[model samples]
Target: MDDARPPRARHRPGAERWFRPPDEERRGPAGTRPPWLSTLLVTAVVLIGSGFAGRNQPQRVPLDHVGYALLCAGGVLLLFRHRFPRTVTCGTAAMTAGYLAAGYPYGPVFAITALGVFAGIVGGHRRVAWAALGGLWLSHLVLAHWLYAWLPPAHDHAAPWGQELIVTAWAVAVVAVSELVRVRREQLAKVRAERAAAARRRADEERLRIARELHDVLAHSISVINVQAGVGLALLDDDPEQARTALTTIKAASKEALGEVRHVLDTLRAPGDAPRSPAPGLDRLPELTEQAKGAGLAVDVTTEGGHTALPPGTDLAAFRIVQEALTNIVRHSGSRTARVLLRYGPRSLEIGVDDDGPATTGQGEPAGGGNGLVGMRERAAALGGTVEAGPRADGGFRVRARIPLAAPPGRATGTDTVTPDATEEES
Candidate 1:
């Protein structure tokens, strides 16, 4: 037996509208329908349906067919709006206002009207949209109460005040939703800009870290080898006994440099799996001076006050300050002797390195490109420390640095020496 439902309630055999996909749904952009065309189509559907219902009504306003014609034209113009939003919105608003004045009497054409205004809010300048909305409100009030006095009843007169309140509330609702969408778009743009800036900062910092590590590893090892090579070449004709000791220093320095490079590479590859042994810290100052002495520079070290444990970053900064200073001496100073002083205090630690090298003067200053000083300053600044380098008043060149005893993460330790607890601190 056939189902005993009403024919309208049943899925009728010939009602094809439900089964056929909308042209917009079938052929539009993946997620969004073209705004102008979508607005036009929606208005057309409302207009045509309303026109059929009102066909037999008397035409109280002028040029009834002309009003319908303008609406149809306006709707068609709206279809291209997304490609040209401002122009389409302006045209639609002008035409729709005219239709309302001509007594088209609020058909489904209002849907297209609302969409055009929303498009203006979304795509046009805030001032323009505000001006347009204000003008629309004035027009609506004039038409409903003044020009069409005998036509439809005014909103506040015929309907209860609550009805007027409902219409006003809905207008506010529309504007609120549109503003929310605008704010979200701006926020997304801001987030993207911040992300791009952060990426650039990380790239620059990584490059600097790599350069500093290379400097530390190569400068010490190379300086040692250079010193030993000089000794070996000189002793070739003289005392071969001392020459053997120089060669051993060269071999040991090379091996240590290689190990340091490997350590840095491993840390870069998997920081979590990096060896427990840390980078050289401030406590290694004695060793650094001895290494320089082995390279033929007589160095003196002085430490003042009972040594307090330094923060890891601060310790590293202290070490780098000393290292860079010694490296600078190796490169520029023509002197054979240097002094390193480490002063520890309650709040901070100070390091100073000076050499009695020949004063750099005459033909255009020593041309070592001044980057050693820059690297030293950068190291100190990273740990909230400050560095000063210049010619000493006592006819020598000095590199001095001050590093904070402690700092938060992501801050510079003012040294390459990253210290942690007591274990790594000793090394």
Candidate 2:
């Protein structure tokens, strides 16, 4: 059984979706119904309204197939409004103008053309929409005023001048509303783009923060482990007791490294959860000196102006800068001795780390050649501070940082507060 139905009678798969009305086409976050309902509703309204309008105006030609076809064409053109806005606008306007020039009743046919104009303007075809609407109005003026007697149902008179004024007002209102809608849509898109960029920036900063934390923790701990491994090997047979001590240092350093690394990783797993342990600050200088001793680097710590409460951010940055400076001395400096000086003023804390060096690696440049110095600078700068590191004129390498302490009167909201130990140390 071969199907011999006309091609238009056959239903093409997904054809309904392709030609759905704009109102029925569901946009993201602006859900809509199927196109068929709007199409049938609008087409029915055009047919039924124009039918009634034809009876009221007996001087106009009675509603016929041509008039009904023109009304339906206006609605059909709207099916392509989203995809072919300019085409829909022009086509609907032409159909409306033809309906008028044919002496068919003026009714809901204009509504279809207005919908096309709205779609065109919103879809970034403002000029095309304006031109389509203007051309249609101009052709109507020509037919109704000058060509009326020759064009339509016998002996037609010129349309009222007031009707032209009403048409111009209607066109302006439509354009104004459409333009407003377009501007609002553009603003919403811009806001979404800005939010996405901000999220990317925040993610990048978090990545950098994690890298710096891992580098500082691993570099210091591994440098100790490396030094102890060498000492353990050298003293293994001779001074077996000294070798045992070296191995002990290795175990402790590895444990601390694991703890800090785990702390950093925890933030990634569950952000906003309170840390299991408090962050290290200058109060932990004695512990830092102990770790340096295991690496064979003797660190001398001194403080001026006594101790003061520091904002958590400034405290963390200061600790990291000093820790990284000490780590570099242990790994790269030929000198075994290092000096740390912390001068706490009323408004700022200045930290200095110095090593009398010829670099162990003989690279006369900065330590590690990694992002160590860069990380230090970033931390200080984030705290509204600065870091200066260079080979000193006095024949040693020096690193200096000045961090501001914009402390609050009492407990602060989100910012870190003065710890209990800091208060007791100040006393």
Candidate 3:
């Protein structure tokens, strides 16, 4: 079947430029028209007032067909004041001037015009609103003079200057009210944006902290498991007793790791609940050395100077730093013997971990790719502390950290003092 219509042409690039949909069209679906309906209601009120004023006048100006038409036209223009505020303001002002000049009775037309001007200013057409107000004021002055000079004075008693003053005051009030509303809306929007940004930042920080906690718990436990597994495998046939001991070490390490991981998870799941176990601190150094010995590493602990109690956060950070350092020594440094030194000063605590082992690589990275050193630095820096880690001149790795002893704000220093037991070797 042959059709009379021509074949459709293919669309070219930028073809939509000529037929782009308007913003209103893209939004789709019209909502309720309550605002426009309210404007129509206001216009009706003005029309009724005008009619009533014209009928009740003792010396009526006798509005003819044209005068009545102008009065109605001015009120009608106000129906669209919100949608086209500037245009409605000008149109209503012109119609009101015509009605007044035609010797029509003064009515509610001026009220409608004021509403239009207010809408224009609130709609962000301030210049147009000001211009309309000035034009209306000037028109009122000229019209008042013409009425007094040409027509016999009726019941009008107000002076022209006084009338103009009242109208000017009304216009100024409208402008001030609109500007206050605009500023208040802007301030509310700014506050909402700032609150949202703060929430996002806090969320990011919490996620990072959780990631660091998981890494610290898992890395140390997994390294011990790896070493014990190797020992168990090597002695499985030749020495069952030693293999069993190695397996026991592995079991204990895995159990402790599981407990720590569960604790972290519980804290995340029920943040309002009290923690099931207290966080490990420097007091648990002996237990940590025992675990390291089980992983086939020898550790020596030494202490010097006064041991003052630390803030909870600082204490936790110090313990994590040492744990991460030792985990690195076990997994990366091929050292059998490691040394830990703790020094307490008047205003700071110094911690040192040195191992007589070959560096994993020339760049001083641990065996497995990890962020242990970066985590150490972050922990120290959070408490106004510093850390240094690198290869030593004696062909081994050394990690040194200095944490300030300043108490946290609003907290008193603990009265309890910890005295470190001199050199203790674990193998």
Candidate 4:
């Protein structure tokens, strides 16, 4: 038994008009709502307006069944303008030209053709719209001037040369309007795309910033806590007093780490609120040295030149760079001592940390693809500066950063540099 309903339609390659799948509706037309409503409105205007126009143009053909059918066809073609703009444009132009060739009175019927051309141009089918509309205009020119004498409803003489100029002006107006709308639509689309791209870039930068801040805060504090915990465990079995001191250091380090982490994370919870505390700066050098001492690493901080206050960004970056460098020394260096040199230049600040060493017995190099070194370099670079790290030919490791200060710090004055054991170096 042969069972069949209507035959299933086979979609031909490159034939857009023959297929309308489910996805076509979900995707919308060119990422916008379809123009079906406008098409229907224009179709109504064409039929109603041409009936009136037919009464005024007695020499032209009246609105008969054929004329109405051609006008409706011109409007129907526009329904697919957004999806297949070039196709709709050619189809509408052909239908309009046929209606004109039959000498049907011209009115809003031309609007259907113009709308198709507009959609084609705006949908990025520029050359096709231009070619179709031009062909339609030239076809009208020929029929009105040369063929009207024999083709229409009775004695219609040749149209005047001046009337041809009006037709030329009308065609120019249609093209100009279409071109302007196309350009404006593209500009709006470009602006929207740029805003979306900018938003994505900002989100990426924010995530990176948060990551860097958390790593800096936790790495130094956690390293100090790790060493203190080890010391406490080793001492608890023998020296109760030393074990108590190690526990105290661990508590302080843990408390400080929690505070800094909270500060960094608070920005995510309440972005517009003022910080709970001021960001750490180089003025806190004494605290850093004391923390290093807890981890059995001595840090000598020597300041040269004017020690004037720095911009908030520069100050915070300098403090973090030094903090991370000393933390690395504590974690990776066998050396028990480190030196931190802070030199204040007229327009920039230079920071250096060095430790005399061979690589810690079995521990490898520290700066190989480590986030600590990368974070230091990134901090310096953000301030329009540079960071250099390597083994000093004199038999030690060195990390130095030079950060430009846009606002020049004031003149140098005599001051004392703080040493690890509370000793002072006069500047």
Best-fitting candidate, measured by TM-score?
4
Q: Tens digit of lDDT per residue, candidate 3, span 323-396?
A: 88899889877888899999989988899999987865443543334578777776676566778887778778
Q: Candidate 1 or 4, higher lDDT?
A: 4
lDDT (tens digit, per residue) of candidate 4 on 1-427: 0011222234333533322222444376656455677778889988999999999988788889999889888877777787888899999999999998898897888888888888787777889998998999899888988888778756888777898787778778888988876676566446546766665654555666667778878989999999999999999989999999999999999999999999887765665577678888888889989999999998888989988889877888899889988888887777889999999999899999999865563223432535777677766766667787767676678988998877224311111111111121100
Better of 2 and 4 by TM-score: 4
RMSD of each: 13.5, 11.6, 14.1, 12.5
TM-score of each: 0.70, 0.84, 0.70, 0.85
lDDT score for candidate 4 against the true structure: 0.77
Question: Number of clashes in model 1?
Answer: 11
Count of clashes, each model: 11, 0, 0, 0
User: Candidate 3 has which clashing residue pairs, if any?
Assistant: none
Candidate 1 wrong stretches, greater than 4 Å: 1-83, 98-111, 146-172, 237-244, 270-277, 359-368, 408-427
Better candidate number, 1 or 2, judged by lDDT: 2
What is the C-alpha lDDT profile of model 1 across 1-427, one tens digit per residue?
Answer: 0111222323324534333333443354354456554565687686776576455433434335787788787777667655555666667767767776666555566566556656556553555555655566566666655666555323223323454465466556656765665566555446546766665555556556666777767876787799788998899669887888888888888888898888777766664464546877877777777778778878888999779987666676678778877866765677889898888877778888888867543111333443556666766777777787767666678777887777647754433422111211100
Q: What is the per-residue lDDT of model 2 for residues 1-427, given as tens digits with 9 covering 90 to 100?
A: 0111223323334534333224433263146433556667888888998889888989888989888888887777776676677898899999888889889888777788888898888888999999999998899889988999898788889999999998888888888878877776666556546766666655666666777789889988998999999999999999999999999999999999999999888876765577777777777788899999988989999889969877666777788889999988887788889999999998889999999987766424643347677777777766566788878776678899987776334422223211111111100
